[model samples]
Target: MKQTIIITDCPEQQGWQKNRELCMDVTTYLRSDSRMKAGKSYQGVLRRDVTCDEMHYNEQMVFIETSNQKRMKRNPRIFEGEHITITRRDDGSYHPNFRPIHLGPDFNVDHYATEVANELLWGLEGLVDNA
Candidate 1:
């Protein structure tokens, strides 16, 4: 079966740019430090679309295949949409808290989309590191 994936930020909220900028800022910070061990490879994209069975906010999902493997496995959920944001920290891990923005009285599409993107990126990070 085909899977549909959506990765976007609401145009009304300026948070989209903020998220991208935060990624770039974090990349820079990680690269500049002397004591930290660089991962040697990193890639990120804005509004990147991905297909997978598992989905979560602020965490990455991955799919692996082998000749003898019979079934696919999924990981646990990480963060929620209402708890995502980018904050600089002394620690090496990248922990961005993504908060949902209300479109009106009850809509929060931007926040939802941002979390998906964050999760996808996190998944990509794991895949690349393993590769």
Candidate 2:
């Protein structure tokens, strides 16, 4: 099954920075997966770019270079390789929610992904509070 995890940072101070860090953590998770590897390292355009018309003004786009482009283009649902977005709330408080996108019947994947995502958020709470 395919799944997408969207981790939003709270609206507190330095929320954008924290959100970026959490996104990095997600990337770390993807990197550790045996089925996946970091795609080509390309300089991503900011949301201000013309191609980013679909994204909100606050959204930052990061391109993921993947191995199996054909599979991704075909199935699209598999979380095996995808570029994810880490969104920040307009209120400036990090959104503590971790949204699961295109989840499948595998309870283990849902459970484990949510578990790790929440743990990452919890770890950020202390850091965000301190900052």
Candidate 3:
């Protein structure tokens, strides 16, 4: 069984380091669920690049790179091995204008996304309290 998970309609890609913070936050849960000491699979969703007709991932895809592919113009961090990758694929399961991608099986994308959203959103309750 392939371990994969996806969360559509994720939080906005804004704010100072918000995306990175959130990813790091989610990475915690992943560290606990994976059967492997470390994950070996990469996952993410595919969406059209707003700047062009080309396709790109909505989020950074996780990957474990061991060799330096300098010719490919990959990020320097990924060459460190076991790190999130900034990669986009040309093929995937297409539906309408988006493609669903999973970040391996270490974490449940659907469940964790909901859990994280709820956890974060709960703080907003005070702002809505009788406002």
Alpha-carbon runs more than 4 Å astray in model 3: 1-105
Estimate the TM-score for candidate 2: 0.22
Candidate 3, residues 1-131, lDDT tens digits: the string is 34544444543433223233254212212322343345554333323222333575343333332332236432221111121122223442211211234578686777765754553344334334625
Give candidate 1 regions above 4 Å deviation.
Answer: 1-105
List model 1 lDDT by residue over 80-101, tens digit each. Answer: 3344433334443445554655
Alpha carbon lDDT of residue 54, candidate 3? Answer: 53
Q: Among these predicted structures, which one has the highest lDDT?
A: 1
Each model's C-alpha lDDT?
0.44, 0.41, 0.35
- Each prediction's TM-score against the native? 0.22, 0.22, 0.18
Give Cα distance to truth, residue 118, candidate 2, Å: 4.0
- Number of colliding residue pairs in each model: 8, 11, 3
Cα-lDDT of candidate 2:
0.41
- Summing lDDT over every window of 10 consecutive residues in candidate 3, give the lowest-scoring window: 77-86
Pick the winner on TM-score between candidates 1 and 3.
Answer: 1
Residues 1-131 of candidate 2 have per-residue lDDT tens digits of 45544455554543444434332212211232443445833322223222335554333344333443334232222111122223345544543334465656764776677766666655566546867
Sort by lDDT, best first.
1, 2, 3
